[model samples]
Target: MLEKKRVQQLDIPSREGYDAIFNSNFLEDVPAALAQWGSSRVLLVSSKTLAAQHGDRIAALQSALGSHRLANTKLGVGSHSPYADVRDIARRVQRLRADCVISVGGCSYSDACKAACLLAANLAPDFTEEDMEALVDERRGIADARPEDGTPLRPRACRLVAVPTSLSAGEWNALSSATNARTGKKQHFGGWEGGGQPDLILLDPELAAATSPERLWLSSGVRCVDHCVELMCNPESAEGRCEGLHGHAERGLRCMLGGLTEYKAAKTRARGAGEKQQQQQGTQEEKEEAGDKERQLLLEGVSECQYGSREALTGLLIWRVPMGPSHAIGHQLGAVANVMHGVRLLATPSPSPHSRALISFKTRPVSNLTLPPLQITSCVMLAPVLRWQAANLSNPHYKTAQAKTLAIFNETLGWREASAADAVERFVRSLGLPTTLRDVGVVSDEEVRRIADKTMTDVWGGGKRQMEFDDVMEVLNSVRG
Candidate 1:
């Protein structure tokens, strides 16, 4: 497994020429950058929430980049992506004659951007809501793929640019994941050609730092684990194939771990202690330097869309990443439970009856000495969420466990992972996050049973990993314990 080119290495910058475009205003130089990209008319893919929070950010674009047409697509993706969301984005991109696109907000918004680019760039023939319906049912990859002009061919040309407000590493992956409204299913699209790795990508940590700590932590946790597993899964995942403590991989590993350490220390003091925000707070230069280090450390496939339109003409391919168990399983749990994606990593859920995530132990082997789990996680991790009381079901369980699920989320501290279910409850309590099923809603004995059975189904997982009904029983039982 260490030698196999898994999927975790695809999120890095392909080249070293990207000039990060970042400004505290969120309105500074982005619009002008969009206008100057190329002859390709720019299309903006964004949501209501993002526009509202940073209305000036979008408006600034219109005023500065009057050189392009704009389009809007809305779907917060905290829950799921409807097929209509995809179609809406696609239709809008075509309407504006947008040659280039910019996505704003969370990973979901970014997904919308990718799908829009694919649809319009490829000119895929319109398959009514019903046509895609049939395709969704078939247990296979894309089939009957054809062009919109009645000709079956790939896309003509169009590019994508992403500006993520959350720490979702997907922004750096070669894959695009979204939920289909019509089919009520989650889908993954993988290939290469989809314009340049964004004619330009602007990753402003300020934007990411603004995200809810829950989201930041969850997303970064997923990425941290992916790096760990990927390094072992693909021995070449680090610095062109150097091994031991003497290579670039080791140095990169050190920085990531260092970041995690600082992250944890800051989180430990966030609870009722009153001294929060310390974990993510920073001066201007610190933020810029952090952003730079982040760019260099990411895999070499996906890059920040900071470069002008140069390499885009070379046919955008070769952008891929290798990921393993912690990632895939984490995805299944997040999609099914509607929880923050990274929380799944801390939870380490077992699939339902049908889904058994059996990993071949012999596949990839690495000693703890080479990789320090605690240091790596504590460093790169984001500030945790604190607010809910554990037992207050209707509110967040930042204090107790028997109450609610997604109560009042105070985006500030980190929640540690506890061993037993009780410990889990306590750990979440310390971070001010919900700790029980009742906190979010479902509580009664019958409700718990139903939750167990439903979790076992994991219908949205697309059978990628089957967790039987009994597994659901275990999870529910553990929560109670």
Candidate 2:
């Protein structure tokens, strides 16, 4: 118990050089990025859908680089960063002798391209499919693997520039997930040789607004919220290590949540304008203005997510604190259950019965820190406690070291006296996200069981507050509903 009160030191992870630019029509900056990366040959990795939508921009980039320098374009990349796809992409990069890789579209394109860049830099020229998969599998989220775990692997040979269109924010971290071809489970890789982090990130609001359904943008904002909350709650921060005045976690949460709220408003306005257009009430000019408004709002949201991504990655790099169970289970949900990554994070879930029981037992002898027992139930409960702390707590830094928690449930979801779990459920409902496992398309209890089993082995699993296998069963049973 006393050990829990002490702040512990953490090893800083290696972060390579990179640049980020935010503006509309910033695709023009690609050539400059290429130049900064010192690449004479460039490969553009994007999806066919994006190519069709932004053909002119692609053409312009190629024109800027001149046809001679543009090595090749690989389009129609798959989602979930499928293992075979990445390997194939790597082979293409190697064959073309591309010096820089540019990823467009969303998480899938960027993740696949990042893996390809890493492989092109490190692997032997004649590496086989079996060899690539074996290496990826071996380094896939080994918990104890650090920069100093051994000699640093080869520096990435090809530089990467990520241009994301959705809110997945995979480009911001030095880690990417690729699905294993055999089991359909997503495996984590990168961070060893800074293979995951991109050399440059371009945030062009107009491009981000093109994402359909508007749900991806909104829910992925919640995923950023999850990242900030966990970093704040992590009790692993050392006393003097980067313990500066800046509150990275709190700032991150503020940016993410505030961005989501603004984006929601913009989406509502856009829908209204579209409906008006359907009714033939709004003029063409008004419709254009509405579209521009939505685009600007989308850009704002993306920028906020980018800022939060920096803070989250900084915490991950400095503290080396394992990602909380929410991330662990969310990855499994994406890989095993086929739920989209953002949707998995946004899905409303009930508290695991075993976790509830653990909280009850632990809080039986209440202490002065005012920690909420029910907050232990699920990751969705993060918002309320954080809101409470921001409003009530005096300490600038959340003293998770002394209390082993930062959660202190108060009014959230606009509810006066609801439990944290209930509040979270209601909040997620307000966002129109799935409220249960079945709602997100889980097929069976056995599938949920399999996900729970695999989650235990995830690199992010088994943290100080993680639910064990039996506890995971209780959660799965609730999700089965």
Candidate 3:
């Protein structure tokens, strides 16, 4: 916190740069992605809901595989990336000897496929439950170990092509989350060491734009907002002065916020057109063109995410940055309580009555935090610095590599008079997302403690910011209402 000057550092992962195709017609490039992997036998993992929505398009992509075959399509991936679901999928992959996996869905489905890819490569084709449990636990321990000591177990190498249909940005990350069978805790595993990163990520805005507005867009869009927030406030970003990847984070946040606003307007325009078409019968060609135009607008918005979010993701996958409190708590909520990742991020849900009292008792702030004392202290003391930066949006320093992030809040978001958190909350509200813990489901006080403990102890990249027990309770209390 006291360092007046520090060495500037930024790491761009060699493997982070993957082939990405961002277009409404991104499915057309799936065969090409598979061909690049030299995959003759491909296995596609998607949700039943998605398959039903775009069955014809998926089928056409399979046909486009030309002589190369699509071994099978598994359309049943449960939410939260359950361990059982991953195990079952791995069995099919091993039996089919699939050379490539095309994961198509939101965060959970994408995470499930990544875990399946790892399990299939490392474990025997017909491993038992005990074997799976042991391997998972081992990985968890190794992941939690100190950086120098923990070398994640590598999985069987299989090319994965991701076709993201939401804004969760899991497709952009290497870490895959799955619940522990025994403890029922959501666990983070897989990274560069484990070879769990996808080979190609296909961002089909047409596909993403066509998803459930409430289910996919609201939750995942906030998840994207969380990403931007973390990057903006990350210790490495150093109050937006560090020109390395911090600049990318700044540009990314601006782009995503602007894109989100445009996307909402496009949806409005598209909905009105649909009503008009219903009243005055429209031709098939006209309908297709209208759909294409809507998709193009959506694609434009999501395209901004690829730049800033990509840098954040790369840092996370390589352990260059630490997961923040919201993320840590979200993981625990998903794992222990069976909540969806995006839902947990948006709202914490109330704890059980008994647990509520327990949480209430622990709501008082602690005199000191556990680790990174200087950093945490710096965080509390840096408010004035941040307020000053936000105040002077036109400072010469703002025109550097990373755009004026505060200006974006003031201009793009109409948050000229709002605090950062307030501005973010307004955005979440506009998207119809939950703003408190009680909105989703009931959590027990025990669950609150469990989440806090696990968050501090669990090992996923975000070392700079972690929540102490008191800190976690304060956050939980603030949002519990």
Candidate 4:
């Protein structure tokens, strides 16, 4: 359970290159933060869902910005940030002459804003698909863009401010990703020399509580868990330069696991109480009081999760360590299968003891006959990949990697006797999240092959172990169910 405390601002390490303010009130804090940044003429970007749900809050922000300062507003950015949508956002930025961009939703919105900024700053008005693709493929920065006359482009002036409503933590990084419209493949964009990252991040627990879906909030926290675990076990982490990340990863692991567990438990209790109250035909006032308490509990959990995610990403952002197969394959799975980046489909009424037994055996395939069709977060793939690494004793880094995994289990989670992979899978199951691809609707062998093939091209695909196509296939197949 989260310890009771007054709301407090936390400091981010200087190396991360931005400022983050954690509070429960965005209506007051967001305008104040923007004021400090001197951002007039702001372009607000959000999703259709958020715009509908938070119309009052959106209006308040617009009022705070004032009519002349509010340059434009764009809504309905699709998931995975489609390239056309990004280009459209860029066009709006250039045409409206906005001085700043504010992303008011999840990581997808932030990614679109960042990518649009890069495109608007570097590329010409008539830049082709090939030109954009080349920029993403090479991960080039503004420094690489030179005029035919040998002049360098000026550093971009437009800044990004993120108001993330989930725990995806993409706002913390300089890099961003968008999907190719034609091929349905997600492409990364950024590497801007002077800009293209969020200059300010606002962590409003109220916004998260109000806007984020329950499954999204919990599973994204697990994504942070993926970040912590993979970084701790990354081969480069054993080296002197990367050793600093271990401490941060450990702290992140502890905070995420503890906070998520508490949050889920609290949510369960609140749900039960609500059901009981409904049965009793409780008064409207009583129900409202219960709802308020529930919201406070959720806010507490969200605050911890925000801190945990920050810690998880800090070292990786500073060191630029690439994550392993899970992230690589997850990217493709999201683009190909239309999987959400962070979501877990809970099996109704829970699994039977026999089903649990089947799930326990990592190598055995479980029949999906009795289960309902459900979607899951891509980070659920982490456990099986960890097991693959642990079992591949022939690999030089396996021993240290396994040791790090064991340490996380022992030191962070306080579990004993279980293998690292099993512990992770069990924890995910405890949260009622699926740990297999079959659970998320990727059942066929051919589908697995396609995802594995695409995984190789991901920036983090080979990583420190230098994983090959067969290696990637093996990892995916293990979790194929």
- Among these predictions, the greatest TM-score belongs to 4
Q: Candidate 4 lDDT, tens digit per residue, 28-53?
A: 76677668878787899976676786
Instruction: List candidate 2 stretches off by more than 4 Å.
Output: 1-16, 125-129, 136-140, 143-151, 192-195, 211-213, 237-246, 277-298, 340-420, 463-465
Q: What is the C-alpha RMSD of each candidate to the true structure, in Å?
A: 14.6, 10.9, 10.7, 5.5
Please, what are the lDDT tens digits per residue for candidate 2 over residues 1-481?
A: 0011111111233443455665535456777766666688888887566567657766766788787678888876665777777887788788888888888867777878877677667677677655555554333354113343453445567778888776566777676777775775667666643546787787666666653236656556566666665665554544456483127666665566556666677777777867778887666898788777676665676566656655654566555665556677667766776553222232333453322211111102223312111111223323333433334445545544213222221211123433434434444455555444554556587888877777777776532245577655555565454
TM-score of each: 0.54, 0.75, 0.75, 0.84
Q: For residue 469, what is the lDDT in candidate 1?
A: 52
Quantify how close model 4 is to the true structure by its C-alpha RMSD in Å.
5.5
Q: Pick the candidate with the highest lDDT.
A: 4
Off by over 4 Å in 1: 1-29, 67-78, 122-126, 133-153, 192-197, 210-326, 340-481
Candidate 1 local lDDT, 111-140, one digit each (tens): 656655555555444634444333331344
lDDT of 3 by residue, 78-108 (tens): 6677788888888988988888888877777
User: Candidates ranked by lDDT, best first?
Assistant: 4, 2, 3, 1
- TM for candidate 4 is 0.84
> Candidate 1 has what TM-score?
0.54
